[model samples]
Target: MQPEIQLSNSTTQLESTQNKVLRNTYMMLGLTMIPTVIGAYMGLNINFAFMAQHPILSLLGMLAVMFGMFMGIAANRNNALGVVLLLGVTFLLGLMLGPILQAALHFNNGAQLIGMAAGGTGAIFLTLSTIATVTKKDFSFLGKFLMVGLVMLILASLANAFFQVPVASLAISAIAIMLFAGYLLYDVSQIVHGGETNYVMATLAIYLDIYNIFVNLLNLLMALSGDRD
Candidate 1:
């Protein structure tokens, strides 16, 4: 009976910690959007002609910057600096959306499509996160599968960058939407299952999932339903 009581108490404490992490992750996730919106607005007004002129160099540079920031965030995950770095990376990502957002806004119903994409992304996140939290199922099994799919997707995207095939681009976006949705489930489940104990890191993972989903979903929507003016 003593051992049983001890195990029960430990389980309760673990659950409490998990719940706190999940709650903090969600709160920080919400806070991240403010900087993202500001960055996007700035991006809209800025000129990216240099990027258009030197596409490959621009892509590589952006990737390098993002990778560096990711490392910084990970290294600082145990402190407030981690949260700051996370927000900084998110703002950079938002600024990087300039080209796509500009393209989407070129269509006759661009604003409407953007709204739909945002709404859909929000809905997907809410549903998947709710399922993960409520079910309390360990989705760690998805880790490997998602990583494989992501690698394949990246390879395909890089290949398409050279080929410049519109259909292939659309296909990549579609696949990306599914892949990141899975990531959202896996990420949120990790928080719920105590697999991710740090709210900063957990928020970063979930934020990236949501960000990718929105970007890909918006790409698909702009491709499929955009009415050029």
Candidate 2:
């Protein structure tokens, strides 16, 4: 009887912790979109011709900044400072979207494609998150496989950056869409199953998943159906 009672109490505590983490993560995630939208809007108005001309340098610079912010956020994950750093990183990511957004907006149906991509990303996130929450399955098992895929995807992306092959770009975009969709499930499951106790860190992981999914989805859509002026 004593052992059973202890087990029940342990389960209850874990559930409570998971609930709190999920709630805070969601609130922070919602807050993050505000800064992202503002930055993206600003990015749209800015001229990124230099980045367009010097793609590799631009990519390296963005990666370096993102790495720095990631380190900052990781170092501060226990306090509100993490939240601030996460928002800063998101804003910078939004600004980095300028070149791609500018390119997309040049197409006749660019706005529609962007909207579709956003809708698709939302749908995927909603479905995966719902599944993870409702089923409460342990998705931590996915971590290793997903990391391997991510590393490979990064290598392919870097290679294609210099090769500038249209087919390789399309393939990379397709693979990225699949990989980050997997991340959506893995990330949300981590939150629900007590694998991730810090909501701030959880929000950052999930945000990256959604961000990558949206960007790659938009790229694929544009490649498939972009209308030229």
lDDT of each: 0.91, 0.91
Tens digit per residue, CA lDDT, model 2, 1-229: 9999999999999999999999999999999998888889999999888887988898899899899899999899998899899999889888877767888899999999889999999999999999999998988899999999999999999899899999899999999988998999999999998888998899999999999999999899889999996
Q: In lDDT terms, how accurate is model 1?
A: 0.91
Show where candidate 2 strays beyond 4 Å.
none
Error of 1 at 139 (Å): 1.2
Cα-based lDDT at residue 143, candidate 2: 93
Backbone collision count in every prediction?
Answer: 0, 0
Per-model TM against the reference: 0.98, 0.97
Compute the lDDT of residue 169 as modeled in candidate 1.
Answer: 93
